[model samples]
Target: MKKLLIGTAALAMVAGAAFAESHSVVRLGTEGAYPPYNFINDAGEVDGFERVLGDELCARAEMTCEWVTNDWDSIIPNLVSGNYDAIIAAMSITPEREEVVAFTQNYTPPSPSAFVAMGDVDLSGSVIAAQTGTIQAAHVTGMDGATLLEYPTPDETVAAMRAGEADAVLSDKDYLLPVVEGSSGEIMFIGDDVPLGGGIGMAFRKSDPEMRAKFDAAIQSMKDDGTLNEMIAEYLGEDSPAF
Candidate 1:
């Protein structure tokens, strides 16, 4: 969900208008809806692990990281199209996607994406909603007899599932845990089989290897210095995920 208090229309208004203007200033894109990773804050600013991590790397790279919040589905295409300098969203490293834009080293190791069918509901022939352009969608595509409904954000996907527009929804387990822990959908994982080992990474145009390398080194250092964990705890809460 590239969702913020500012809806998709407002997000697209700024996202579509953004461009990398100065080499010294790197323009980064994020979904701003993936909590613990990126999301809107109470003060109306983008804040979360991914957002803070981007800020950290920008500080390390000695370059200005100007953030442009956008829909997750458009992040890669727009990067390839040269609309931004980098993408700091929680994007996965999938072979299908690598054919388009390039990615930094995995920031967050691959966590299994899961399908939550209502209760002990059977997902054998159900319609599943997933964030479009995600590995979860690709996995849903492979499930036999299941129809895939792609939404731009997980929030929309969940909303659709709640409205009876979709039978189940697919997303990373960590993100879903926080949102669905007490939701009244009888929601539960369909199964843990067919896990896709795809890790989330920062992304950029394939043409920007040098910049990617710079950010990669910066990110790793953050992980080494305990900065990453601190930020993760800050956004996802103290009882945050270990994955």
Candidate 2:
């Protein structure tokens, strides 16, 4: 749900012009692995919450846009390199990440982080699995006497727990809730929820304030009209917090 890696390279204005031109394609990068937030459908196309929300935002902003999938680990660097214009992946607005890429105002409210295990397990001194480059991983790293097993994807963290590689898996609760429910009692939550990050927002290269401002206005528009809250309930869950 959160990632931070330093990327240093100025985005050229030629590429910035793409953000300026009417009907020009703005590539929105995402992992396409995290679901409900984002995932590839059976049609092998990027589909899910961000896909719909992004399309609406682009339409409101009067820009043409397309989806681009990249590994979670490299999503930020690629954006800095102009591989994509922005990141609409379910990324949280953490100060660490803000050091590298400027974020549009958050679109989704902060969700809880949670721990799930094969059965009820004590979190103290337990080995926990978390996705690489996520806030959960960073949080687990500081837990006293708890070992953190890092995986490169959300699915891997769950797989690691199922394989007995970790006592539990730590991740965004929204992503883990479906897994826990579908596990048929095989996995259950083990601890109080942990809240991390400011909220979920789109990330853009630091050089593209114009692009950032454009999307921010569109997002603010949604928040004002209650469409953002409607989409949050539809995509995230009815209980998810509103703007």
Candidate 3:
């Protein structure tokens, strides 16, 4: 979902606040609702894998950073419009996105997308829920005999499936694993995994190559020292592909 927490008003407070004007603080933008990737903790603070990874990267880069949350759909445009600095959400590096913003080297490898449904659902002609503006939604649009139901958030896609509005929900396998395990046998994988995107990478405005380069070097440093792989396993799962 590249999705989040923090209200629109909070987002507006940072809109058009250029990070380029100050090297002291780098604002890291994320959809703070996606757990194991990024989410809001009980204390109402940003938490999860991206949070840990982003903080470490900032430390390595010797940059002071603050987290900002924004909705998934307008994330790119907001970055361009200077809502925040880097997008450290689970945004996959893709050609389409590259047209709008530059990317740091990937932090996570390509992971499979999967379908989850309530029992024995056949996907051939089923209605599938996917977050709007995601690769899963785009995939469903071209899938033979499948109907796409777009939701604004990842949680809503699952809600749609649970409410019988959609037969299945499609999203990153890592993201869906916890939901399935917690469903008390109500949900299960319904089909083969679908692999998409290059990998998850931090996004920056194209005009900020220097910023991109800074994070890229930090990511590469992590990869070299195996810290990135350690983080991938701890949060995404031991089976998650490593750097």
Most TM-score-accurate candidate: 2
Clashes, model 1: 3
Using lDDT as the measure, name the better of candidate 2 and candidate 3.
Answer: 2
lDDT measured at residue 13 in model 2 versus the true structure, 0 to 100: 24
What digit string (tens of lDDT, one per residue) describes model 1 on residues 1-243?
221121143223322323333367898888788877889899878888887778888999889878788777566656666677788877777665566556787776655566676666567788889887667776778879989898877889888988999998888776787766777646766777344645677877666777888888987887888877677667655654333
Ordered from best to worst lDDT, the candidate numbers read 2, 3, 1
lDDT per residue (tens digit) for residues 28-47 in model 3 = 99989788899999999999
Q: lDDT (0-100) at residue 158 of candidate 2?
A: 94
lDDT of 3: 0.84
lDDT of each: 0.71, 0.85, 0.84
Q: How many backbone clashes can be found in candidate 3? A: 4
Model 3 spans > 4 angstroms off:
1-22
- Candidate 2 Cα deviation (angstroms), residue 40: 0.3
Q: Candidate 2: where are CA atoms >4 Å away?
A: 4-23
In model 1, which regions exceed 4 Å deviation? Answer: 1-22, 184-186, 233-243
Please write out the lDDT profile of model 2 over residues 159-213, one tens digit for every residue. 9899989999999988998998999999999889998888999998777888888
